[model samples]
Target: MSSHHLVAVDWGTSSLRGALLDADGRVREEQSHPRGILSVKPGGFTEVFETLFGDWMRPLGTRCLISGMAGSKQGWVEAPYCPCPAGLSEVRAKVLEIEPGRISIVPGLNDSHDGVPDVMRGEEVQIFGAMALTGLRDGLFVLPGTHNKWARVKNGMVTGFRTFMTGELYSLLSQHSILARTLDTSAPLDEAAFLQGVTQSDNGQGLLHNAFGARTLALFDRMPTRELASYLSGILIGEELRTQSVHAAVDVVLIGSPALTQRYQLALQAAGTQARTLGAEATWAGLHAIHSTSHRKT
Candidate 1:
């Protein structure tokens, strides 16, 4: 590892991940904390962050680059989303200010048309990293998360994208809604039930209409709660797959955790859209890409 050091963070609503990388961009050390945005409360980020990084700071003199919800309206500070076709400099200039450290915040991107708005945060870094790796000028990139995003890359820029709250809605209904009463969170992913829901979801059955099937199926005792939960999972994912305009002619890369990528790959396979796992080292990949550009420019 190079002697010089920098930090990269992917902070979300529920958890925060940070990496200490060498000047050459290899991760030397990393840490995570429960001081996610939700847990930090309003204006408590400095204290919470200090608790997480106080020890590491003794090593000293490391600059930081952050992505994800950390730049959102509710995060530590609003770094503001840059419009599409933005460059590395435009993103870098929006970095939020912090004391006692050199920290840069990567901004989100937004596009609106026909009274509908599509937005993204952490995925932009992955997209930039993917372009650097693949040398692809245009393709489809999918980032699966609480708010799954499907993006269209054109001429090495994010020309357009859409967000589907598939994971978030699943969590909401599964935990807080009546569906929770009828669904089992600890249940395994039932391939059979998953396939059934995937198939049904494709047959012109609208998502809202199909959502009722979960409870209805349970009401008649035709589906077990575990199976129902699995089916619901398949339903939302499948519906998103069916409706989205994925550019399959160019390569489609999926960036996310292994299980999420696998589940999406299975669903895309069922929908006849091919996508490959792009690895789960998003923060590292993003950090390396940013640091490389930072070096080139300097």
Candidate 2:
């Protein structure tokens, strides 16, 4: 018998992250590449994936669990998203097949009503793990990233979620638009400007109107580009949180990279909402738990 273990992947638009986990689910080795779904040209997924996979599969025995955009339309193959209120059975049903390996792609959650669609990818698993760890059956989990997601979880299942294009929009305006030229990437966050945006834009009512402040501040030379960038980030993040934090009777779990989590934590604190940070790696832990419970093999 082969001593195969677990391999969990968080595949996204700009990068592919893989971790080799032992029987107890500890990450033994990790590998990454910028070969996300968007980076691969049409019909070239398998070739690119093999290249990335071969670089990591040194131990040669692992059960692969995948998540995120790798299951999208442009990925290696399509694994349709399971609507909200999804559970373990739903995740199991949407698993994908890979060559010579046991593989599963965590499906995104899609819920649209009144012409608004909220979607998410790899972040959900991490949220699930966080929920499992804290045993908080109901609350809001905010995963900050290129597409910030605020998810509602109840009874250990993901009830629903909404995605805000805050990070992506910031990236665009900071790089492609005129704002890009004025914003300094290295400057520190200006507390006054950030607080101003946070207090003013906390609700959706004045968000769009507040965004122009970034450009205006830049034009008047009242704020440096770097501080302006921080202020802009505060505004967008503030907008999303204000709308989502309503009726958040339960605590909020802010999950993502440390920097992002800190920013949200600070924002949530300012809004008088209780929030805490959880790392993205929790998804891998949850995947391992699911795998072990199901007795699934490599």
- Most accurate candidate by TM-score: 1
What's the number of clashes in each of the models?
Answer: 0, 0
Worst 10 residues of 1 by lDDT: 92-101
Candidate 2, residues 1-298, lDDT tens digits: the string is 1345877888888888888778877787888887778988888976876676655554555567788888888777787888878765566566666654556666777877578877777777787678767778788888888888888887777888888888898888777877677877567767667767777685556866887888888899888766887888888888877766455478788888887887787787787777878785678777776666456532
Rate residue 31 of model 1 by lDDT: 87
Q: Which candidate ranks first by lDDT, i.e. highest?
A: 1
Q: Clashing pairs in model 1?
A: none
Where does model 1 exceed 4 Å of error?
1-3, 58-61, 87-89, 97-101, 133-135
The C-alpha stretches of model 2 lying farther than 4 A from their native spots are: 1-4, 41-43, 55-61, 202-205, 296-298
List clashing residue pairs in candidate 2: none
